[model samples]
Target: MKNNRNRQVVLKSRPADIPQAHDFEIVESDVPDLLDGQILVQNVFLSVEPAMRGWVSNVANYSEPVRIGEVMRSFAAGEVLQSSHSDFKPGDKVMGMFGWQEFAVVGPAAVTRKVQEDDLPLSLSLGVTGLNGITAYFGLLDIGRPRPGDTVVVSTAAGAVGSAAGQIAKLSGCRTVGIAGGSAKVAQCRELFGYDEAYDYKSDNLDLALGKACPRGIDLYFDNTGGVISDTVLRHLAVGARVVICGTASFPTWDPWPNGPRAERHLLVKRARMEGFVIFDYASRYEEAVSRLSQWIRDGRLRYSEDIQNGIECAPAAIAGLYRGENTGKRLIRIR
Candidate 1:
């Protein structure tokens, strides 16, 4: 009977600045009986993303915060074990916001899209060919609009979304420059993803590195860590540049309004446009992006990395690890 129990993580408290283990509680309960129109899923991989920080915070954001005492919101890829839904059957693979749990009983609305077995690992559905890929594809191409010879700079370049965005920009004929937090990530951006240039924002001189790497100035800035790193990048924007504000990793809290150098004058002088992106905005077209991302991988034009933690017990600290920059690529918790 213990084997039939479902283990899950729930939010104990909304985080003040950064999430800690105490903020989450792992609970085990009897697996609920399947309901009409519901499918039972045995979650395999749970995604840990930066956006989770905002989801658990009290700060205003694009989406509603994960209410306290609810199962922590997360994206997961899993296999169907039982189904009352017409389309899903036992053994079918699926991906969706299945939360941080070993098993979930959900309806069709909870499943984002059905996944097919392919040469790529199913975990890729949570990273390169999933949300990260879709986010990078539309966020960079549709918003940043990089052109041939354009200097495209991506902050947090070693991260899942940032790495994919940089690679896509490179494939589009743009000169890609990645800004990462450490020497290891910088090396990864350059060696693994083939960024034209990569810099360790922690160790490298910000001004000097930008000057050397972007001699013509940045034509497209994919700003992920939108604190000091983005502030410095703004100083190098080319005329008519497009800045895609994909994330704000460095800012711990937005409620108090962290102060930094304003980009108003810079934007005006450079005649550039800056915009924010939410992956859900492009939800209807995720399949299209995933197909192309898959093709890119098959043709060897794209690559991805995953840092998998092997237990549901890791859920509490998984997102904290992301907040600390402990993850090199996509962070996933393997909870089979």
Candidate 2:
């Protein structure tokens, strides 16, 4: 067995704005023994997402906030070291809310699913093949309801979820345009993700760029950033256009409620539909999305990127970096 000592990152303080390293504290403790229906997992990789800021903040969100002095909540990929449950045994690979810890003792509820794609890397269970890809799959297909020959525009188009959604739209026979930050990510949106057109949201005249790229208007808008980018896309909606609000990465604080242009006028004029998408709503159908996503990877119809940082200590800093648009793909922390 590995050493009994477990190192964990816990919430030290809630950030006033973007989460910083000072917001978390790393502490060492003894790994607890597993009880009946519990499994001991040795965490290998930890996910760093923009949503994590909400998880740690005092602000209300869809999920309960991670309490102070508790291990910071996170999705982690790891191997079961021991199991008191019949369904899981030693050496079984799994992914779940294992928190920001070196070792986790959890029940079945905390275990999202057993990692079954043996040919794929375990780290992927936290990235493309996991929530990121699944979110894109259902949000675009089910919510956006993309049709052939439609013009789809994706905000944060080079991001983990955005990239997947864009490629999936292309696979559905829609013309895809990507909006990302910086020249590199715009280039990545075009070259790597195969977007028909990509614009740097920072440098380009967004209104004119969107007008030119989506000449016929946007049939589907997979919105990951819900600020100015979305404000711009809403103006370009085609008749009956569908908008999927996946994330609001641009908002530093939702406390005072940052003011923005209302979208009702645009939706009403175009008779469009805009709906929020939460991945947890489709938890029952995760396998369905994963199965198709896996096949897409096998068929070369899908591709993904990962920005992996070494060491569990990097987990806290990674969240802040993600909001800064520092990562090109799914950002993960490899526990060393």
Candidate 3:
């Protein structure tokens, strides 16, 4: 038996649809003792993000794929339980690329940040105020470039990244619209996320709803899911509109790459610009975004929520939940 010390989630199988519980297995293992610049962290919270599906898919992407039977990759926040690294210390709370496991042995190079436990919720360091928040800032403003009085629409608007993108667009003085999976999420978008308009993709005809809300036409569209949703938005783009492509959650099938409705005619008619961005490329500008978002959060200008599950044993389930739209806000599994 592989009798090590960490409780980790390993790939048990691949899925044809939303990942099921059986797709992963829990096992115990121990990391080797820390070397000169390494540290062992007892995970405090494991993040369950939508992009995890892409990471596990068979198709090649910007990064290498996670191999079958390997520990599932995740972004997590934890405490330094043991350390030999010059920068980290015992009792420090940090966020990094540590995957789904109770104990993570990571070197200094992978650590994204060390956080403080103050009035702000610590778990959020892994969510809205962390990567998701930063992603919304850069992906929406730097890429989508919503102009004042212009209309902006976001898919998966009630999700972590989508919700933040909508709110930030609203703050930028643009008319904000949202497309979410259910009525509950739609309500959250109009009320909680402060979207000027929101529609349930499950109930309302997306074309009709988007047409109604964006009568003036979409000036900026931030896409988290592609396929029909993107096609619908493409038909409504105003002249010179900017579209930021983030992810494609709608396509569950793992083909070689994404191909969808031909959008060239829409682009030509609107004279629009559409670009895809991987947030990791903006790593150097992360600090500036975090500082701005933190201020907005502190000034009662931001409203954020969370769906947190307890224990590392539930970590695999948490990651699978994002694909099925099981989480409300930022999905997290508490692992202390």
Candidate 4:
């Protein structure tokens, strides 16, 4: 074994709201021997997403919650160190739900996909070419169904998924408007992601800003944060508009069930549609999305950013940082 000891961050306690470092504890253990059908992977990068909050929360979600004392659930990029499965072999690069650990012994089913883009950075597997890119590609194109010249607005515009969604919308010849937390992110939306118009939801009067940005009303709304921002966007939906609910970062908890303005009236008045999709539902088409996104990257039609922090110790804090809007793009912890 390259290293006998494996370090991991486990969920120490469930957080009432935003996760804190105290909610997790780092522990070290001996690397286990791989069993039949199992692969031993040494993680290179650990991804942190806003959805993680729900994973550890007691609330009922699409997936099962991570129990206390378990390795915090996470998607990671890593290399296969040893494999007992015929489908996998040593030296293979892979991405999967390897959790917040330096090393993981998981069955082949846990391996989401084999990393094949040697020309691309392995870290990109956990970001642009991985979950973020795939989510944006399917959510925007399939769910949002953006049309050319459509006014498409995205919340969390500078984030990993949101940035990709906005850029993809632009590629579809839609006019894109972005809503971000601060001026810097707003600027990143307009300058970095090529959003035609960008607004700071934290500072700008969102209702009026949406009015100015989408005078023709929003033909498509890629909503990552659900709260007042989404409520405002719902009010401005163009006739037959499409809304994709990708995340709800604004809500601290769902146990109490946070309430907001009803969207039924807006949908009724505009004949619009709103829907949510889990990335796992589109797993069969993951490689397709990755291939197309990679091509876009090569053609210079797409761009993405990473807010990488070194070491597994940063794993706990990284989740909280995302909710604080501290990350500039995809938040990752370098395990090596």
Candidate 5:
């Protein structure tokens, strides 16, 4: 078993709803041999993102769906165990699409970045200092441009992306309001994440809660979950409001296209602008975002939380936990 024990979680079948543990099979295989330009990386942490739900779904999406029997796609950070590439050497830390596996045989082209850990933790490459922060940076600043004193609202405000987006909006001089699922997360949003106001969307009267939180109506909205929560937010949008469609975490599938209230009339009356953004579109400018995020970290103007789970065995349930609101912040699998 030691000789052929590269344990990995592979998709056993397409999930009819949200993917569950039964849909994956963890199997052992021989560790891959190194090629001329490839390196062997032993993963340390695997990111549990909401986007993974869409990846495993049997429906159309912005990217190709993960085929059955393939290693589940994920972002991970790890150390190079062996290398045959000129750009990388053993002991170097890196982050990329390394999937839900213990060890990955990756070429130089597959490496997203060779991490430079000056005073930062390596796990952050998969969290705050990585895609989560980058998504918040561009999506809020570029699309949902919150002006000074403007009331900016964010859905899923305690999750990774939403937390960062709310904090960024607060730092930019906006009156930030966060909408989370429960009382615990709502408190975390206001106390820990620096949101000026927060409300529990699961409350009996969410419209009243939102109205009380944002008495001026919402000027900018960083929308992460697009369902009834968003439907309510749309009703209170200030004239010329800008909405950033970041994710639809509340929707399980889009095959039949889940129906909701129409937006044309709201946009027409409010003259609101809604735009969609994908982080990969700004890949060329990652350094720019990272620089600002790092500075914010250094200045103590930014803070983040991570809900880490140990062992590769816990990988299958991580995504489901994210959907169920079981995590308080960023969800990750620490594969030792």
Candidate 6:
């Protein structure tokens, strides 16, 4: 019999707003015998991203909700320890849709892509070159479409997608203005994330702060936080601006899925454009983004950050941290 050798975090409860520790139950399980073409992988890094929040919700989205009592849904990076699959071997590093667990028995279909070095860390394969990177690429280039010399504004600008979006805007020859939750994150936006200007949205006078930072009037708005902050940005948009709706982290809850930026009048006034995007729409083009983003990192034009927490036991709090704006950049849990 195959030995039981996995540690996992199971969803204990459906969260009302932000998930809490009580929502997960960490437990050990027996591993089943390998099927015809399966591989056992020791998960090394697991992505604890804001996108997980949308997946946890019962609301409509491109991705399905994580069913109650299931292992919390997640993306993970791992090393193969045993393989019955012809394509995989021990020690091969892989990235896949593994969940909140330390070990996974994946068939060929579960493996998404193999990790290879191209002047970047393996962990970043879970960040900039993976789902997060693809989201930034499509959301900014296709939806936010900034023009040269235009001023682009990004909310949650120190986080994974926001950081990548701002840098891409700058590379497109636009001035980038970033707004994030706190002083530390705002600092990272300009110095680390390569934004042209940045502001702390926590400032009481956020509207005034945005007005000052975006003196040229916003040309393209890559909105990761949709709410009053996004509302204020819409008022500052230049004529013919584009807004990409990627997130609403600024809101407290999603049961009602709080509304954001009733800027229809602003869009009408400025002759601007607004659209909602889910990154999975461009999954086929993910390789194109990975190649370009990896090059940028090699050329010293791009950067990434991770707030890694240890163990599956911390998964619930780690995931919840994103909603509280407690994480500095990309958040992940080290499962092994």
The residue ranges of model 2 lying beyond 4 angstroms of the native Cα positions read 1-3
Error of 4 at 268 (Å): 0.4
Tell me the tens digit of each residue's lDDT in model 5 across 1-336: 126568899999899878888999898889978878899999999989999988998787778989888999999999998899988989999999999999999898678887885688888888888999999999999888879989999999998999999999999899998999999999999899989888888874889878887777889999999999999999999999999999998888887889989988888999999999999999899888888888898899989999999999999888877888999889999996
Which residue segments of model 1 deviate by more than 4 Å? Answer: 1-3
User: Global lDDT of each model?
Assistant: 0.91, 0.92, 0.84, 0.92, 0.89, 0.83
Candidate 2 structure quality by residue, lDDT tens digits, 200-252: 98899999999988888999999999999899889999999999999998899
Instruction: List runs of model 3 lying over 4 Å from the truth.
Output: 1-4, 16-18, 256-260
Backbone clash pairs for candidate 3 read: 4-29, 4-30, 5-29, 5-30, 6-29
TM-score, candidate 6, is 0.94
Q: Would you list the clashing residue pairs of candidate 2? A: none
What TM-score would every model get versus the actual structure? 0.98, 0.98, 0.94, 0.98, 0.97, 0.94
Candidate 2 local lDDT, residue 106: 95
- Model 4 weakest 10-residue run by lDDT: 1-10
TM-score of 3: 0.94
Residue 122 in model 3: lDDT: 75
Q: What shift in Å separates residue 315 of candidate 2 from its native position after superposition?
A: 1.1
Q: Score residue 304 of candidate 4 by CA lDDT.
A: 89
Error of 6 at 119 (Å): 4.5
Q: Which residue segments of model 6 deviate by more than 4 Å?
A: 257-261
Give a tens-digit lDDT track for model 1, residues 1-336.
Answer: 225998889999878888888999999889888889999999999999888998888888888998888889999999999999899999999999999888898999999999973688999999999999899999999999889989999998989999999999989999999999888898999999999889988888988989988888999999888988998999999999999989888988897998989999999999999999899989899888988999999999999989999998888998888988899789999985
Clashing residue pairs for model 1: none
Give the per-residue Cα lDDT of candidate 4 at 259.
80
lDDT of 4 by residue, 1-336 (tens): 545999999999989988999999999989988878899999999999888998988888988989999999999989999989999999999999999999999998889999999988998898899999999999999999889999999999999999999999999999999999999999899888999999998889999988887888999999998988899889999999999999998898887888879999999999999999999999999999999999898899999899999988788888888898899989999975
